[model samples]
Target: MASSFSDMGDNLDSLICSVCLQIYKEPVALPCGHSFCRVCIEKCWESREEDCVCPNCREVFPQKPKLKKNVAFAYVVENIVNVKKGGAGGTGGTESHCDVCNGEAAKRCVPCEILCCEQHLKPHQQKEHKLVDPGVKMEELRCTQHGKPIQLYCKDDGRLMCLMCMGGQHQDHKVVAVEIAHGELKDVLAAKYPHVSQSMESVASQLQQVQEEEEQTENSSRDAEDRLEEKRRLVCQFVNESVDLMKSEIKKRKMEKLSLLGKQREKLEKHMESLREGKSTMDKAFQELEAVSFLQDSKDLLKRLETMSHFKSMKMTPLPVLDFSKEEKNLDRLITLNKNFLEKIQKGPEEHPEKVDLDQNNLRRLYGRSPSLDPNSAHRHIKISQDLRTATRTCTKSQYPEHPDRFLYDPQVVSCESFSSGCHYWEVDVRSSSCWDIGICLNSMRRIGVESGLGENPESWCLEKHYNKYSAYHNKQKTDLSVPGDPERFGFLLDCEAGELTCFGDSRVLHVFRGNFMDPVKPAIAVYYDDDSVHFVHLVK
Candidate 1:
């Protein structure tokens, strides 16, 4: 019966799974006592959530049955498969049945797939064998290359080697017994892990510190930009306010001067009227024949003379005086302005400094300077006054020596003094000129064709006026200013540090330019049309 049960026949076919077509792996018995491999049934009924039916018996389970291995069936299958494969016996035991002797065996021949007892498994045997021990799981102890038990470990190759392999290819390789190699490797790993861990921790700490420093640097950059922008805002506000105050001052001076002159004219007009009345009276008396009429008119003329004499005692308006240097009120006003400016600087925007009026015509003299025109750089068509204070476009050319700086086409002249630092301002008196260009230009640009035109090249910046229209030019880009402006004067303000050039049309801001400028910017005047004139007002500081 035992032999029949162990036979590889129809009865053993029941152990095979229908799904895998292989011997049942972890066979389980369902509630209906129908058996199936656990993996095979799970895969087949995966779509069913509950109440699964057995594939073999078709018996429904209320809930998908929890599976447990069939221990008795597992034992039976193992014994049957083992016996058919020519193993020891149908029972579970450590001893093996030797194929040659049919007796208890001590070792199994790996390549031959047979068992061998102690006598046949002698040390001098040529066959490969491993000790059989059913009490413990068998570990891989044999080398694949030689089909012999692993006796040594080759450290260089990191592999196990048999006696024959070690003596041949592994002869020079560093090797030791397997037990010693395992123990040494473990000890080395234990010794180096602490140092590696410490190094990793140090690197992590330094990385954290570097990240923190980068954040701080970014914060500092943001703060610096904010502060810089704030400073620029304050500076711009102060400069604009100053221009406004200067404009107000110019208007005030003009009014006061005109008022004083008007008063004197009124007094003189009354005196003239009285004299005319006396002349009329004497003429009438002289016409009325002879000494009788003349004697009669003499009394009336004396009375008129007496009335005119009363006006003579009042002195003429003192030349309508408003000298900045001599006037006590103007000096006091300037002192107050300087004090306010200093206070604004010390206390910042919170000071809210009130605008202080200054001389309009002398605005540049206070904040900057207007240098004299260079006689050598003047155009032949430009006639400089004898005082070198005014320039006019002359019809006939003078026999002036030809200088390299002389204008070739565009009748332009440049200043002798150039400023590279600090704020500078100047006034240009266009004075009803039909066409003109007033600006600051580089000394290096001129004496040829279009280059002589102010703001035609990269080196020049100018405001152009022609035929009752206005336009500003810089780097060859023109901007129309719809503002016709007072045909008399314009102001220019240059802030070298701030890289700003501002043009004012009759005290109102006309155009502004932002850019870096080369050192020594000179004021320039260009006359492009007939009868056009431009002059730089002497800004006496």
Candidate 2:
């Protein structure tokens, strides 16, 4: 039994201080069945404030525990100390002991508030020390600044404060209790973070899309440039083609002009050559005659000379020296050639020739002829009667005739009286009142005769005012006749208000007269003739 106990004691002595690694000089027992030097365990518990656990088995301790010094192990260590003695290793030098209070070794339990040596440590924990669990103590503690428990969370400020802080400086700010704020923030972040990430991804995608679009645009620009180049080339080609075509056309026109002018020059040259040939032939013929004369002998020459003198002495004179036949033929041919050239070069209407012949006998029967007609008359009466050979007529000697407002009477010798064939006419100005009666008489009379006794009355001639009388006379009998009782002949009366002229003799509406009678005192009447004759007459009121 003694040996067995000694062996057990040896095993126990082998376990040393976990902190200083030596045999325990002052040993303390923990509630966990672990042992350490009293000072080392106390220091560990005070500093760490954690559950005490055995270093070897990891068994946890309940609370602060008392520690005890092992005196028997100290005696063993002192006796065994001589064996381990060296100059630096004696019992006094190698010993690890608490320097404070230098009495029996003591340990302080922070929670239990006891000093203990090795033997009393377990009992001190059971009886004297008050135990506190670390987990429960942490739950009861509060922050030093806030009197209430700190529970609420502030996400923006990243702090925990009590309810009192919610109404203080932090009021009106975003805040929640710790649990609720954390939960809501977690949900918000969970929902929005992916969208933010997707937005970033979309930005990258858009950049790539823009890059591709830029490339396409650049390609399109290049294509447009190519098309522009092609268009420019085509335009240049068309311009050059047009220039060539115009050049060719100009050259063709120039050649045509040259050809036409060349033909004209050739014709002129042939004419000149013909003239030269004729002169040369005439000269050669004269030279041949001279040569023939020179060849005759002197006696033959004398006899020829006497014969020539005998021929010259005859009374036969040379006829008028004219080659009319040859000259006429040459002139005719030249004129024909000129006519052809003019026909080729002429561009517009040809002018009318100076005169045209008409059947005068047929025309005279259509229009009434004057009784004093002369075949060899020099003056043609268009609307006035004159001495046919001298173109002179008698009127009143004074400048003012009988009635100043009356129109003058003149015998008009018309080539054709038909309105369709057109005729020649004339007008005169009258300014005397004495001529008004004769004007009215002429206007009222349809036909007038040179012989006063030819009509019904011996003293007065018969005249008609109706047109049928003149038509029947001219168309059927082809001779003028007089009506039975002569009406007062008013000459061709120009009614300015009606724009008409009524004539009595030869009464087929011969003329329609129009006048502007703004000045009735000196009204001007213009007579227009189809045969290109016009005359303005002024009437005195």
Q: How many angstroms is residue 41 displaced in model 1 relative to the true structure, after the best TM-score fit?
A: 99
**Clash number for each model:** 0, 28
Model 1 regions more than 4 Å off: 1-365
Candidate 1 structure quality by residue, lDDT tens digits, 1-541: 2343433357567678777878877887787877788888998789677678888888888877877556556666665666644453433444456567887766665445456667766742554344443222233557787767777999889988888886787899998997798678666655654564465555555554656677889999999999979987986787678667766877899898898888888878988887788778767766877787678678877887787678668676476555544444654775698799889778765311221332344555557575677778888888776656566777878667977788878777888778665677888787747788888887788678865688888888999887778899888889999675455878887777668887877667778887766466888887766665666776667
| Maximum-lDDT candidate | 1
355-440: candidate 2 lDDT, tens digit per residue: 11222232233322222222121112223224321112233222432322122332221111111112222222222111111111
How high is the lDDT of residue 126 in model 1? Answer: 56
Q: Report lDDT (CA) for all predictions.
A: 0.71, 0.41
TM-score (all chains, Cα) for each model: 0.34, 0.21
Report clash pairs, candidate 1: none
lDDT against true structure, model 1: 0.71
- Name the runs in model 2 displaced over 4 angstroms: 1-187, 272-541
Worst lDDT run of 10 residues, candidate 2, spans 432-441
